[model samples]
Target: MTEPVPPRLLLVECPGLEAPDEDDGGLHLRRFGRVVEALSSVCPWVDAVRPGVCTLPIKGPTRYFGTEEAVLVRVAEAVGEALGPFREGGRDGEGDVGSGDFRLGVAEGVFAAVLAARAGAVVPAGETARFLAPWPVAVLSDPELVEVLVRLGLSTLGGFAQVPAADVLARFGTRGIRAHRLARGLDGELSGYRVSGMGARLVAALGHALALQDLQPGFWGGTSAADERAGEVLTALQRRLGTEAVTVPVLEGGRGPADRCRLVTWSPVVARSSPASSPGSSSAPGRERKGSRRKASQAPLEPPWPGRLPPPAPARVTVGERPVEVLDRSGVPVGVTARGLLTAEPERLSVDGGLWVPVVAWSAPWPVEERWWSTARRRAARLQVLTADGVARLLVTERRRWRVEATYD
Candidate 1:
């Protein structure tokens, strides 16, 4: 078997950089992109896993610069130059340039590089296992695996790595085996250990091409604080319950109140854009057409439905097992005649057997017939009434029974 490739990874991190509040715009990504661009000048083979954390293959850069330490110093200088002047008290306002300590780590694999970067140290070639031995298993970011290891009295990477690989695989599956490997300084699938020197050269060439393409300037935009907070809360709630726990109210195309609206899975990105842009509008950059409103309205329209309800839709509507009662003066139930009229005008109403409310005013009943050709045909007459307490309700009568269909706030 061929010997494992010696790790040649370089991890670069910007210390004291906080994730920007979504409201602060894309400032975080922009700054991170700038850093990536700067580091590309030193080593074109760069991968930005997140805003502040980045990795690079150091073999080619080290050969070019004559030493691994020289490459690290060059990367630090590039990051500082890209970040510009240092601002005291951290990043303050929009458009203000700030600088932070740039930590560089060089080791055999990605995981070892990350650990070294955090400690501001460099692990020499082939010494990754010794360097990572004393670190905690929590660095793997797998809470369950860490907990299991701690319970087994294996808290440090060295202790956990002592376990048999087959046993770890049997106990924890693929993820557990991966953690075990990382603890042993074997960074698993994505690390340089899996790639030969020839493969690294090819990957470096492809990365360089991609970096050049990404150097093009891009526009940035801000996000709403309310939308950001709402997304965070929804994400947390989904994590506790299942993803199906959170839903959003969406308006659909229909005449009936119930048919016009629906509940859908919540999406933060979609929700953020929905409130600001209109349907069919050009949301893409530089694609907006001027005077599109007139063009849209002037387009051929569908034949109008004569039975459509007039303006002033109800603000609230409740539909479920609970029923409301509408009664006449004699305490008898109010019924709708075959001619789509109330037999005895509504005199009182009660919701869910609550206190009776006297009707102050009412409008003429409007009939709505649905599924006329089917056995499940439904016929209802709706009446808008004002109660003595000044509440407006839309009451419907179907099969000689009355129910509160909706209400105006």
Candidate 2:
């Protein structure tokens, strides 16, 4: 056996993702071509002969580039330019998803490098064992071997790798030994591949749904109360999802929930708003109606919509693959977004054909039943609802009577 030259490896995994069921194989090829072209510019020795694969031999480039960190930055920039414009819009304004979406991993052995690329992670030289130690057992195919190891409590790559190779083979046969050897980064079939340019090892996406309740209130003169509420809901959601904080503005104000105007506020510019400069203000009838302020005296602990309420406490939100980092007033990463009232767990509260309430000390619907047909009543039914934020006790009526007794979010 001979030791191979230590080569820095770049493995690109393109899942050929497109609109679901659109099976456009040619588009996938074009994506690969774009990535390869980007990578080749940085490392002139790039090649794209493999289908949906570009192997970059980084030995020469590493020496020329001086430091791997610098190389990574340059490659990330080049790939970003090559991918053109893949941005995360709507809520996240940090940066767009482009060439930088790619993952690069370097290791002493080719097999480990390939695995690292597939996993969208990186392992510096001589740390293959440490990197592979926490990987799942399913990375290897044999189930019987896994069961035997589990019974012995030999879980994790590190534990399995420590067992004698001969003993593993003698008990579980050749497949078990092969699995063990692979775990130790000793695969014989891994052939080193050449690099062309830039490639992405993984891709993550975020989809957003704007708050319906917030946009109902007017943005100007504080008519869009629901818009602001929607913004609050969005803030709560973002806090849960683990993304950067978002600013919200009204799309329309003083309309119904569906008619409320709302949109995400992004862009680095912060221009001051002038009251006289607002568009279509001269024609709006409510612009001059100054008796009462529409903006909530304080953002309500619970929204005023008929059936809507702030969720209970102890919520968990995952924005994407990246962990959420809540920022302080100074814009520094503060903490993960998981907490009480932020977890958006769905719970249905209803009876056979009417409104139902739980936690009332009995299964019978006391509050709703008492006020079934009280149209002229000033006060009607009071019921408590549970959510991720906390418990909200609400009062309902047949007509213009409504009040929220308590809420937790």
Compared with the true structure, what per-residue lDDT tens digits does model 1 show for residues 84-183?
A: 5543344553335333556788787777887888888888877888898999888878787789899999999999989999999999999888778888
Clashing pairs in 1: 7-108
- For candidate 2, write residues 1-409 as lDDT tens digits: 1423245465554333222122643444455555654565456554342444444555665676787666666666665565544433445523423322555556545556656777766666556767777876655655777777878887776788888889888887887877777677665212224333222221111122221112222222222423443554566566776435564454343212222334435222321231223222322342321111211222244333222122342122211221112223344422111111211211332322334333322111112222224774332233334423334333222232223333332
TM-score of each: 0.44, 0.38
Candidate maximizing lDDT: 1
Candidate 2 Cα misplacement greater than 4 A, ranges? 1-8, 14-22, 44-54, 86-100, 114-121, 141-144, 188-409
Model 1 is weakest, by summed lDDT over 10 consecutive residues, at 216-225
